[model samples]
Target chain A: AQSVAQPEDQVNVAEGNPLTVKCTYSVSGNPYLFWYVQYPNRGLQFLLKYITGDNLVKGSYGFEAEFNKSQTSFHLKKPSALVSDSALYFCAVRDMAGTGRRALTFGSGTRLQVQP
Target chain B: GAGVSQTPSNKVTEKGKYVELRCDPISGHTALYWYRQSLGQGPEFLIYFQGTGAADDSGLPNDRFFAVRPEGSVSTLKIQRTERGDSAVYLCASSPDPAPNEQFFGPGTRLTVL
Candidate 1:
């Protein structure tokens, strides 16, 4: 089975400061990882995905994530945080070789709070 | 270029009742998925349909939960004997064929069971 772990329930950062939300995974084979953001009462919006190739993947809203194979982690990052970035974030994973199992497994979630 | 859409944004029902949630995937998307999001938790996979067939229903919790996509564009998730524990947000997503790198999700249907 594949799974994602988000250790922090909440992350706080001041405006213009850098921010990071950690995520790790456990899967049998290669993994397809993705990050999504959810605004209040809104559906999850795709942020980015790491299918293969580049280790550092850029996403919407000036967000990026690093895929560390050695660490089995994909941590979401932003150079400078904005108050509008405050929202719920989720990390999801899917086994590349898991036939017929295309559904993604998501982490519990991390709440990002950016203060002005 | 409309995104995925789900019907009945909110539904409230009593325990032991039956309910169905609908999902209209993005036009031309061959893959559709259903997930449940509990309060304070991320969305959990329930099922996945490729074309007109259910490629995966492994994530479904029990027999009471079922889903189907008849024409391959629209899907519906049916829950039988709904329990209070079933109350949560039902999220639908769709992706293009070949691979599902990024899924477009709908606003989700919030179900409240009393």
Candidate 2:
């Protein structure tokens, strides 16, 4: 079964400091990973996805994630954290080799808190 | 241009009652999905629809949960004999055809079973 694990329940960072929200995935075949953000009382908004490409993939709102094949990790990162960037982050994985199932398996989620 | 939209943003019902949640996918999106998200948990897939047909329904918890997309645009999820455990936020998402695309999500409908 394809699954994602977000080890940290919460991550705290100061504004202008680099932030990292960790994510690890387990899948049978190639993994299609995605990062989504959700604000309070709002739906999820897509940040980026790592289908197959370079290890580093940049996404919206100055966010990026590095796909480490050996580590089986895809950690979301930001060069400089902003207070407004604080939100709930979710890591999801999909097994490309799976049959007819396109739904993504999501992680428990990590709460990012950027202090001003 | 509008994103996916769901009706009855908040619904409070008594246990054993029937409730229907509606979802209107993005214009021209061919794939629609229904997911249930409990408090402090990620959304869990319930069903998937390609056009007017249900391509996958394995994630549905029980037979009491039913969904239909009669016109391939708007979908409805009907829960019969709702239990207290059924209280959660029901989310609907949509994506373009051809599979493996970023799904656009709606501001889920919060169902509260008393």
Q: DockQ for each candidate? A: 0.85, 0.80
Worst 10 residues of 2 chain B by lDDT: B95-104
Candidate 2 colliding pairs? none
User: Which window of 10 residues has the lowest lDDT sum in candidate 1 chain A?
Assistant: A94-103
Q: Give the TM-score (vs. native) of candidate 1.
A: 0.98
As a whole number from 0 to 100, the lDDT of residue B52 in candidate 1 is 96
lDDT of 1 by residue, A10-49 (tens): 9999999999999999999999999999999999999999
For candidate 1, the docking band is high
Winning candidate number (DockQ)? 1
Candidate 1 chain B lDDT trough over 10 residues, lowest sum: B95-104
Model 2 segments more than 4 A misplaced: A98-100
Model 2, position B2, has a per-residue lDDT of 97
